[model samples]
Target: MSTQMIFDYVIVGAGSAGCVLANRLSAEEQNRVCLLEAGPKDRSPLISIPVGIGELLPGTRYNLHHHTTPQKHLNDRKLFWPRGRTLGGSSSINAMVYIRGNSDDYDAWEAEGNPGWGWKGLLPYFLMSEGNERGTDAHHSGYGPLSVSDLKWKTRSGHAFLRAAESLGHRPNNDFNGSQQNGVGFYQVTQRRGRRCSAATAYLHPVSSRSNLHVRTNSQVARIILRGEKATGVELLDGTKILANKEVILSAGAIQSPQLLMLSGIGDQDQLRKSGVTSQAHLPGVGKNLQDHLDIIQVVEASEAVSFSEALWPKLLTAMRLPELIFLNKGPLTSNVAEAGGFASSSLAGGNPDIQFHMTAVPTFQHGFNKRTCYGYSLHACALRPKSRGEITLDSTDPRKLPRIEPNYLSEPEDLQVMVEAFEMAQDILAQEELSRYKKKSLRPEQKLSDRESIIHYIRQHAESIYHPIGTCRMGSDELAVVDSELKVHGVDGLRVVDASIMPTLISGNTNAPVIAIAEKAAELIMQRSSRSFVKENRHTQEVE
Candidate 1:
């Protein structure tokens, strides 16, 4: 708690990867680890309940709740970008959908010269980190920290969506993490016994009593203290300096990790100078190559009152069912809104599906903020991979000030074309007989837009982020690569980044699972370095004698 305090490893950001790193690094009884979080502890009642995502997402204490600069291509709309600011990071506030993305996503990383990062290379770590309720197999493990299970509460609309998807000729696959990721089915959530199982609950909370691990909440890290080229420690916003004797790992998610790097003067020299920060390392790629998934929605009014809209559930009925949810863990309270979905290949897809669908049992108005008064359900389709790129630049020298986020959505002409095709694909599935029985009327894109131009127009007006942002501090062998294959900063020692920001490219699905896996591997790397250091110290002692 003091400025003179020192730690063997000081991890900034108590987020998804940060929680994993804190647990693994402190496992060694002799090693002292310090985990700092800018927000408070994960004690909110909403954070524990699965359906509470709707409340936590808008502007709760758990969310960073950032907004992007107006996009030139998206009719100059400033999209709301919410990142978790709590103990579990986005894992605490996310929809709880568990997806590892495509296997080829990792394989492509290996192709880009990042060895031991391919699907095969990382599968073992994935297996080690997961605790699937379905038991162990080649693709999953039953004894791990994070719990992955089927939804305890199901809606009729979700089942209809899957049936409708099957009618469109897509195969019905139960496991999205299986050998193939091209099918329609329900999503597995990160929950245990109908409650949300965030990274804090999975990893950190279970081990908080360990004497070697120290977790400081509501302590914001201002900047990394670089002694020449090496990151020796970090300074808090209050001017307290805590030294890191061995290493400092940044797990502040995609946005803040790069922003912290830039604040610490590890980014482009020109950019650092302009922001009034003295240059420490001239890495031009600190905030470059930013990527995120963009999605569009199609809402349909339900003919029956089966949907989970606010109007469908009376206040007294919901209050009466509290006993069932508390005792049995089987009720509507356990629902993770986006229940069922699938992956499909668009016209632009090569070997794998390029578009993904997320079908919610409730009607969503502006990311679930403005709830519709009628019963309805919605389906979302997003481009898995986009050609358009963006960047994060400095807004000011103040560490507390948010960075300027420019996703540059639809900057690439081909991206808009793919969106048009995805829109049409989503429309086809909603019109199938399985779902048509419940459909009363189409609520969005009011009239069916058949022409490509009209489809594009509809997209620009309604499209928004699916909340997966990555690639700012990319890892590669290219000139702009910020980190190497080992996740170590290319130009600095005693420092590494272990979050989504280090991704060379965005993965094909939800990012939480992959981020946890990445930290599992990083923990091993850090322990390996500790082993070698201990051996060298012993050898030096023998030479002196």
Candidate 2:
């Protein structure tokens, strides 16, 4: 009673990269493409409004609600990791900051044996995928699928944050993705008008009418269908088979991509056997090299009513803003809460900014799950690149079971030291005269951090992830690398990973923009390869005729 379907290209996961692949690969009329998503359709109003991230992050409706295994270094705390499950994936639930990490971050990837991934090589792809409101430039594009625009409404505290940083000798940078990345400024967001412009909205939705492409929602893949060393397609948990006539692309993010590989008998032999699954590829690096940005927030009470606390506004006032948000697309709802932030170099940095900041005009605790009743602002500082590495491993052979995620934060001594420096620098910026007018008292640390020991103690107690995780299925020439520079799975033919998981190392800033760019390059590579194959097949046919 199992069903069977086939396509030229089968993309697993309708996420940021999957949506782009579906759009590009299906552009050729002859090529049939199928995109499978395990979650529901992204039809919620909360997903469209920019500020709805507050409601999205706290629940499981649109989020995967994944959590990490206990960290041995950070007092054995299990951190919450929420990933978007709907059509847009994390792009639907994210804050929509349009930051491309430091240019050196990509160059370092090339230095680590990944050839065309350097900033010089990838910049074109970034430009191709962007549609900036600021119009065209050497570094930006005004005619791409993804919309990048300035927030229509920014909180008053956001303006004070930038001025405070500038007062502390940091230059004011209008564009973080410009000539230099060192300074304070408002962040550009992935929005069009006042609504969120996720990869689904930008790339997939417009092309959904194409006859060559088929999108399947609520289709949770159990495992890839492998014939010997090659991936043929995938099987759903409900006993249905989806066959890929050409190739199978995994864009299921960092955590699940490798899990799918392992479930399909293509991972470490020992681990597969332990998990009660047979091994086919014996690739030891299947789920290794996990990296994420560890962030710590400094919350201070504001003397005035500048924060986004609901307690400050009357119920009638909140209800009246609905028409402004819907009809005019202008109101407080337009604000992408993590509105203004900047990059800074810690004392331990080597030229490029080692720390990134996210200044929110709201006092958010535990990823905004705990609602606050007071007025306060928060300053988030995270290490751009961390030495600490963690992993994702299978808990059971069943795909329904979630993977074991151990971020292993602050395991490296240097990582802890860098965090200490980042904390001190954030404290300094918050104490600046421009922000002193609004500051009333510190909230999180609850005491003055006078020295290194106190700062270290505070970091371990308060630090959490800013939700940028990568490198689970890294791309490199090393033996531990799961994918090559071309993004093909090393030992498996017709199988590739084209998401943030393939990043050889973590980038310097927010990851969403970089992930979209990665997908853009991947589509081009796939098409070129397909074109060459078509030419060869036609030549053989003509010769035989």
lDDT of 2 by residue, 35-101 (tens): 9999999999899988888889997888998889988877778898989899989999999999999
After superposition, which runs of candidate 2 have C-alpha atoms over 4 Å from their true positions? 312-316, 529-545
Looking at model 1, report the run of 10 residues with the lowest lDDT sum.
Answer: 530-539
lDDT of 1 at 293: 94
lDDT of 2 at 134: 97
Q: What is the alpha-carbon RMSD of candidate 1 to the true structure?
A: 5.5
lDDT by residue (1-545, candidate 1, tens digit) is 55667999999999999999999899889899999999999999799888888778786588887889999988999998999998998999999999999988999999999998999877877776788999888888777789999998888999888888888888998999988899999999999988999999999999999999999999899999998889999999888887899999999978999999999999999989988988889999989999999999999989896667676455346546767778998688888989999898877888988899999887787876787877788889999899899999999889889999999999998788778888998998988999989988899967678888888888999999999999999988788999888899988999999999988888989999999999988888888743334334434543575
Candidates' C-alpha lDDT: 0.88, 0.89
In candidate 1, stretches whose alpha carbon ends up further than 4 angstroms from where it belongs are: 312-316, 529-545
Give TM per candidate. Answer: 0.95, 0.96
lDDT of 1 at 37: 97
